[model samples]
Target: MRVCLIASGSKGNAVYLQSGESRILVDAGFAARELSRRLELIGVEAQSLDAVFVSHEHGDHCRGLGPLARRYQLPVYMNPETFQALPSLGRVADLHHFDTGSAFTCRDLHVETIPLTHDAARPVAYVVETREGRIGIATDLGIATRLVRERLKGCRVLILEANHDETMLRDGPYPWPLKHRIRGNHGHLSNGDCADLLGDLLWDGLETVFLAHMSETNNRAELALECVQRVLEKQNLCRPQIVVGRQSESSICVSL
Candidate 1:
């Protein structure tokens, strides 16, 4: 299985996962044209995508669904709430309504959607298992739940969010109310929040970890890494190969 970061952040969120003859996308946040170009760089064509699994109605996660799926004739799956929020497309439908809880099979790939905490109607984090191993992709969430920690347990690869630096967000230019929303339990995960969550995770099989969905004004890769690195060091866990996902571009495919 090959996992590619198409994009990640408050700006946009997308991931391309391929295993054998199957290829699926976790989100379609980028513009249709830009998404096609990014996929091509990773040796995939828009028409080759098997399906799209949406997490919610938030534009950062679903903005391009209508345009991209329609243009390429791809199937889309999501929860009923998320489905209702999108523009109707011939092949798009709700995953929960389909009776495929957080877990479903799309071709040879097995995907599990872990429920998420956010302001959206219904949101989720995704864990994809393939012939290669298990990989979890989670972001745009605030505090980690017991379910999330369990679902992501032992993932060979992890794409988790380290969305902000609390201090930077508080003292930086954004207003207090906006800052409260971000720091709220229902909002994004801060660097410290991310570190604390990873500390409690069982990391035996974990190989790689990428800090995704960071705020441009409030975070730097170095800070995100420092937080995780400190926690990993204290726990005596395997120093998982770590990378930071950028908002403007996709990250290189890391071994999962």
Candidate 2:
């Protein structure tokens, strides 16, 4: 399996995943042209994508879904609620609606979907099971539930949300209500939240961790990495290669 984060931040979010003969995008946040450029940066053509899996209807997660899926004639997979929420997506040639907790196959990959704790109409996360191993993608989630931990267990690669630092969020320039919303159970995860959750999920087979969905105004990459590392060090566990996903550029392609 191969994975790359095309973009990760408040501005937009997209992830590229390829396994066997399957190539798919988890989200298409940027415009079609911008998504194409980013894919080109990683030597992946947008037209080569076979399918798209949407997490929710948030603009930052699905803004480019309509244009990209239409232009590429890609099959889109999402829960029925999320599809209904995307009336703005206009007409898509192919659509597949999978139940939130069901597992489905996309060509050579087996994808398991789990509902996420977010304010969207119906948000979800994905665990892609490849021949090599499983790759878990869970972002825009407010908290990691038992079901999430269960679904994500045994994954070789994890893309988890590290949305903000609690102190930074409290002291940052954003107003109180917005801050409260972000700190809410249906909002986003803090750095501390991410670290604690990761500590519970750490294991020997975990090869790489991508700290994703960071807040530009309230969190730093160094802080997110340090927090997770500290938690692992205290437990004397072997640390995985942790990479911070950047908002402006594609991540180094990871293969397993």
Provide backbone clash counts, one per model: 2, 0
Model 1 C-alpha lDDT per residue in residues 137-244, reported as the tens digit of each score: 888776798888887887888888899998899889988888998998789999998998888764767777888888999998888898998898886666788878
The residue pairs that clash in candidate 2, if any, are none
lDDT of each: 0.81, 0.93
Q: Judged by TM-score, which candidate is best?
A: 2
Positional deviation of residue 116's Cα in model 1 after best superposition, in angstroms: 1.2
Q: Which stretches of candidate 2 lie above 4 Å from their native place?
A: none
State the lDDT of candidate 2 residue by residue for 1-256, as single tens digits.
8999999999999999988899999999999999999999999998999999999999999989999999999999999999988888999989999999999999999999999889999899999999999999999887789999888989899999999999999999999999999999899999998998898888889989999999999999999988998888987666788989999999988999
Looking at candidate 2, what is the lDDT of residue 144? Answer: 85
**Which regions of candidate 1 deviate over 4 angstroms?**
87-101
188: Cα error in model 1, Å: 0.3
Question: What TM value does model 1 have?
Answer: 0.93
TM-score, candidate number 2? 0.98
| TM-scores of the models, in the order given | 0.93, 0.98
Residue 216 miss distance in model 1 (angstroms): 0.4
Error of 1 at 183 (Å): 0.7
